[model samples]
Target chain A: MKKNRIFNTITLLSASVIVFIVLAALLFTGIIDEYNGQLLTLAGIYIIVSLSLNLITGFTGQLSLGQAGFMSIGAYSSAIAMMNFHLPLVVSIIIGGLVTAVFGLLIGFPTLRLRGDYLAITTLGFGEIIRVIMVNLETYTGGAAGLKGIPSFSDTGDFLKDSIIKFSWVYVFVIITIVIVNNLINSSPGRAIVSIREDEIAANSMGINVSYYKIFSFTMSAFLAGIGGALYAVYFGYLNPVMFWFLTSVNFVVIVVLGGMGSITGTILAGVGFTYIQEWLRFFKDFRLVIFGLALIIVMLFWPRGLMGTNEFSIVKFVRKYIRKEHEGGSSKPSKIKGVK
Target chain B: MSVMEAKSISIVFGGLKAVTNFDLKLGKGELVGLIGPNGAGKTTVFNMLTGVYSPTSGDIVLNTSREGHNYKSIIKLKPYQITQSGVARTFQNIRLFKDLSVLDNVRIAFHFNVKYNALQGILRTTAFYNEEDEITEKARDLLKIFNLQDKEKELAKNLPYGEQRKLEITRALATNPKVLLLDEPAAGMNPQETHDLMNLISFIRNKFDLTILLIEHDMSLVMGICERIVVLDYGQTIAVGTPEQISKDPKVIKAYLGEGV
Candidate 1:
């Protein structure tokens, strides 16, 4: 057990170092072009969104279609805070997340009682309601024209001097989001959430408060999505009601589903991969969406469990088994026992 | 003193009376059986006792704690709340967390007892690690009791039918209940497995010092294990007595065993 703990710490430290080196290298060398840098930032933001959605729809087994609504709430709230109140970028972003979390609780209270398709439809309606409210609130949200001149991190420090340096902030948020969500899902409360998904009655019998956990998962999902939205607003420097339409919400759900529904690493990979693929397919123009839809369908048909299928990619486990070969004393053959799935 | 008591409890679902004026008094460490034929409201009585169904009119009280205080009414509480109050139950259908490992299936029931909170969990604090280590150790001990330690890492769904039933019981026991309700625990078991289960049930009741309420259709198992039996028919108690007295009752024979038995 002591050895395992040591292995885990080592794996975490090594992974962090690798990520830091990669990001720093990208910034120093300016190897990635502006277009790719923008896509990378977008991927980071999408990863946050997808991970949050996975908390609700994947781990908690609640079909929520209102993620984009929560995202819009965050985007608008943070933009308004920074522009009107002149709050620091970090403070405004946090305010954005808290505000959206409140909205999540409100929507969650009534609609969480409904399950499956009914829940899905109600959340879809809620997303549309958020969009309509954003569009009609002309004084606060600038109505259909959208909110503009949202200050970017480039306005803050030496980050603005180089386009690649701006991605550093996003990468940090992405890491924070991943760590928080990963820690949450691997904990006792996380087990309760998964139990609810497996069997509500069973979960209740085992002394889990089903309703409370459901609301918690939903609220957390919204909170993280709101953070993602704040990042999106700051990165793009603008926000419109149309930018958070029903299709946007669907896009998040698609990302979560195409990644393994419950796999964090899968969602991260899919989020980044999907964003890059969309950018790459820009040449097709009008037919891009058609081809994209076809590709999704084919992928779904081929890998129905999504990319990871309820498995986690654990660096510690990999290191212990492969790199150190701790158990077998440096045997060349692979261990028969599979890792977590 | 009675560990659990229900007084004149009844529930009506719309126009139908599911369980009517059911009363029960379970003494500490007693092994009681609730038996009836099909559709006899056996599971409904268990549900009411566990707070799955709130009694429409009567009171349910539990005096599980060691403190010399008045018995607390539990009818108004939620199922999970009732469990925390020291009443735990197993399902007739064997509701294990199918995808979770057998260890997790049992460990999750210890959620209320674990001393770590969400913040501790997210931060991986010393308290969290200590509590988690403790929980894993306790859960392993529980699985060891059922000789399931070897299969601790196996998913609950992948277990054989008999082991699945055992896992469900293990999970219920992990809650450290004062009153353990077993809902048709021996269902779908072969005679050999049933015999083993009967022995296991008695062993756990003594080992845990638990007041057990058993629901079963098998007469021999109930007769062999239960010190006292309560017979029900169509949401009404037909007889309540020792196994010998219950088997001899005319109403019990007619309602449950038919004329020949």
Candidate 2:
């Protein structure tokens, strides 16, 4: 057992090192230029938010339509800290997440008692309320005019270095978010959370605290969304209340549903895919949104359960299956081989 | 000593009284059956005892063997808290977590007892692995008892109906309850299945040293295994005695067979 553990650790470390080197090579060589880097950074930010939202809606079976509200809290607070309190960038981002978590607990506690549609409506209202409050807080938030000239990643005055720094924060965070979310889903508390999604009353009778998990996931989700927001704020070097509107919140819900609610790999795929598609469709001008809408409808029509439908796509499992098949069926036709999962 | 007792519990919803002045005592290692016709509030009584509904006017005291903690007032407590107080129950409809694996359904019952917090869980700490592996072992042991060890990987919803019912019981036992309340375990079972389930219930009552309160419409099941039977009609207790006495009671007969007969 100890030998296997050590081997696994070695494999993971080497894999991480290889991925980091490859990504750095791409960025430094200007193979992934400024525009693509910016788009990828945005996609990574969205992926983090989607993963967090999955913790609440997919695993815990709670409908929350106010993710963008948490994001706005993170952005504004982080921006405020950088400009007003003169904190370092990382510390500001942490403040953003912590502040959003506090709001998550406060809002999630009372509203979570109302299940199903009631919770959805309450969260929808919450998203709008946060946006309206941002518009009115003229002093700190800059109200309707928005907060501008926030610290940018381009501190070295070189465009490539700026994009690299931004993408690095996003890449590291995307990895962190994935690790944490996957770890949570595989553990004991994760079982309790998923059990609640399966059947609340049954989970309760089986000694799982239904409400506590609901609140915990909501807070955890809000914290991650805030981190995404902080990243967004730094990427653009600006904070805008208009960016975190009701539509923004609903957009994430759409991504989560389209990605396959509980499937982490699907969310990452959809987040990056949609971001790339939207950015690349700039040639269509106003027609881009129509294409986007058509794509969503087509995907849903074909795969009603969304892209992955609670099934994860694991690269290791895929690789191992083919390797084992080759050893067992050496003379078998390659044409006879089927998709593993 | 009684493991759990409901002292004249009553609950009213607006103008209607769902359960009226209901009293039950579950002595240690006793297997008691609650029998009633449809709409007689048998489930309501179970609901009240499990803290799904707080009695409008009564107290439910559950005694625990844990040192220094003799009894807990389960009245007005959340359902999970009631389970934590050593009372676990299975539903009439076999409410297993359908999407989860059969093993997970049982493991979830061990949630309250796990010492590691969410941070430890997310961090993959040593304590988390120790507790998680222990839970998996314990849940597998429970599955072995129900002969569900082979089907542990199958989704709970994909299991055969009889196995699903058994899985529900296994899950309840995983909570380590002193008192186990089973609502209609034989609802959809065939005669052979029902017979096997009754034997299983008796086996667990002995193995786990449990006090069981069961609700069933199956007369033979009630009379064959139950040491005592409580009969209810129209939200009121019509009879309470051994199966022989309950079988002879005029009130129970009237409730089951009706006035013309």
Candidate 3:
């Protein structure tokens, strides 16, 4: 018991150290300064998109290849809101998410009833349909040229005195999105999602409305992707129809798989990790697709369950087990410290 | 009125007619047995009653409240909705979330009743934790009832065969159904385990105030515990009566107990 408690404590402390070191390196070294505000926004947007993809394909065990299409809906909706209705930035983004969520529901209602491969094909078709519509709708979406001169929504930073208080709005947005997704994946609904993924037949017998939960997972995932798209549009100050391509959706899928399916931490880590890799390996741009494909295949072959697999780390369970074991066999002599026995 | 009534139900699987004009009724706290030979459609009848397969022509009416104010036509409801209307069922084969812990297996079945918002869950709000605690307490109490409290953390797949079957029943009971269905629950049990299962079923029925309908091939187990018995042969009801009447029926004797006859 004593050994287990000490081991758990050490694990937690090491995790905290790793998190602290990474965050400090990102903020203190000004490594992200190289990217323009637009690139940063796109990165943030991909963070939401990739995380949402992880929630569906990773946690829910439902394959989806239509994220790019959902993101396009958000991009076009926000662009139209700003260009036509002249709405504020926040309202437009919210509306964008709502519109995309509705579209998600429309597609999910029918396709979610089918099995994994069928759902994947249906989503892939949906993504292609959205792109085709964008190319055809020259009036609102700018056709081939796409919408331009969109106003910038967020800026880089504002420093105070000796202390460096960097509020990169892009990073802040990404952090908040990550936190929300993290919390959701760890909550009751998250458990439901994971349960459905693990065994649909068992989930149904347990009285979990399988269809309802599946649709909800799909809609929520698309909603986040839409938000990411809107953020990208606003940050970049421009938009184009070509941006929302089928390859973009595939990229998100690769990100989820590489990071580890059904893992919030792994998704975030992979998102940033791949983004840096993509940039660093830009010289070998032709090898980008090759390396990404190989990585996915290798990971699946070696660890078919992904990096974290199905085991979620729980600090509280570890702590309780440790404390119970320590008290089980230890000496029962009264201690000198206050309230000790 | 009976708590559950299945009137003139028929189910056909590609002209095979798996169940033909099958009828079963259950009053509160009644434990009924359905027995038949191989391919006798005892499970088909259970499936029709549970809404897993809708009848070709019939109706299932469930009295959801003591006053009957919340009555529903379960024939029109989906399987999950039927569960919410106070009907739960087990499978012929043990179907469990094999990867999940035993406690989670039960708690997940309690999802329909546990009230908390997605927002509250994401925020880890007080209501979330409170509801979680309540669910844990109730699940633990249920485990204690089945003497499975010590194995709460173990995965469902790691449990012994009898324990796995018990866990499946525990999961079904977690839904708090007014009527529970069991399919071939004693398929692989020894005599000792069979006796224990019989006692557990009786104890659970009285404790939960549940009306149970069980399909089993074990004639002795069925005759021992069931208050009433229904016999089926080739998707048709051959007899329905007490143990004595069923044991003596010539048609049932010909269909299932030819050696004795």
Candidate 4:
């Protein structure tokens, strides 16, 4: 018990230490201009969106291709509230999340009861509907012209001004989200979601209200997506009807699949990696999507469980391996096949 | 008083009467056996009792007024609601969450009793931690009861077939049901496994103070564990009596022996 407590304390201390260092580095990284900082903020937004999709498609074993739709709901709702009613940014974000959650429940009530492929198709239809509506509702939404002058709450100020980059808000939110999601998946309810993903009929017989939990998962996922969308509006200070197209929803799925569907940290890592990779390949931006398509196909074929599978790489495991290695006098590296653990 | 009473329960699917005029009564603390040939509607009876399918006609009254904090009838209740009403059941096909750990398989089933909200969960507040610790301890206790404590971290799919069957039962019992239903509990077991499973069932019933209603094809196992047996063929109860009486009943003999009676 003492050993376990020490291990836990050390883990917590190290995690905090790592977070503090990262924040300090961000504060000192003068090379990162306001523009680059904003991009990082966008990554944080996408991180939330990607992780939310992971809940339904990754953990719940439901094929949901409609996260972009939920994000749009959040974006529009939060953006409109701030732009029109002049609501506080935090309140707008909350409203966005709530609105998206209600809409999620509305869609989930009837459609989530359907089995596999049917649900996928239904959610896909919802995504299309959201896009079409955003495009058509010219009076309220400004239609294809898009909404603008979103509050620039996510912008980083000049370092000389003694103002920490508001970009840290995005980073903090994303990191907290990652931690919470990880903890949730490690918790009992999270395990239930995984069980449902593994086998729905089995989950049901185990006294899991399969339908209720499925819808619950969808609702929570949409809630997170809405939160991300709200952050996106704040960070980008602009929005367009085309931002929530069906393809964007598909792209989020691609990101999750390539990252390892059920891994929270893996999703965050892939969100940052994929976003930066796409931005960096902007010179050949036309081919950017082709590469994205290729990455997903290859990941599915070669590493069907994706880059990290569902297991997190932790220092605890490393320490264990190191101890074993010291006793045995062998290198700590496992075989590639065994390393999948 | 009987805990679960079903009267004239009938279900027809298109031209076929899948279950017809089946009557059953399970008293408190009774272990009842339901046996029949293939497609004898043994599972259909379980389904009706658990509210998976409402009977086309007839009534199912499952009185859940043991203490009367807030008692509700199981008849026409949702499947989960039936669980809350103290009726829990296992499927014939050994349904289990393959990816989740065995302990989690049972823990998640206990979510009905968890009193924490999403905020508490996200924040990992005092109430959340308290509830979580209690849940973990309870889940571990349950795994120990099933002799699966060592395998708590192992995924459900990794366990052997017989162990998986036990885990399914463990998951069911986690709901704290007053009455438990075991559908074809010995379906895929070998003879020795079936014998041990029979012992396990009786042991669990005694330990958990459960009223068990079991459907099985293994007549010997059911006959050994159950004090009373209900024989059904073509969705109709051919006989209902003690095992000794059921073995000698002319109608049951005819149902099994095909006119040899």
The candidate scoring highest on lDDT is 1
Clashing pairs in 3: none
Off by over 4 Å in 3: A1-44, A83-86, A153-167, A313-341, B67-72, B257-261
- Native contact fraction per model: 0.69, 0.86, 0.58, 0.42
Give per-residue CA lDDT, model 2, range B1-261, as digits (tens). 788889999989998988899998888889999999999999999999998888999889988773334776789788988899889899998899998889888888998999998899777677876787788889989999999999988999999998999999999999999899999999899999999988999999999988999999888798999999999888999899999999998888899999978
- iRMS, model 2 (angstroms): 4.4
Report the C-alpha lDDT of model 1 over A264-310, residue by residue, as the tens digit: 88898889989988888899998999999999999999999899888
Relative to the true structure, candidate 3 reaches a TM of 0.86
Error of 3 at A279 (Å): 3.2
Off-target runs (Cα >4 Å) in candidate 4 are A1-17, A23-27, A30-39, A154-166, A201-207, A314-341, B67-73
The alpha-carbon lDDT assigned to residue B114 of candidate 2 equals 93
The CAPRI category of model 4 is acceptable
| Tens digits of per-residue lDDT for model 1, B178-246 | 999999999999999999999999999989999999999888899999999998888998899999999
DockQ category of candidate 2: medium
What order do you get sorting by TM-score, best first?
Answer: 1, 2, 4, 3
Residue pairs in clash, model 2: none
Decreasing lDDT order of the candidates: 1, 2, 4, 3
Better of 1 and 3 by TM-score: 1
Q: Is the docking of candidate 3 incorrect, acceptable, medium or high quality?
A: acceptable
The per-residue C-alpha lDDT of model 3 at residue A37 equals 27
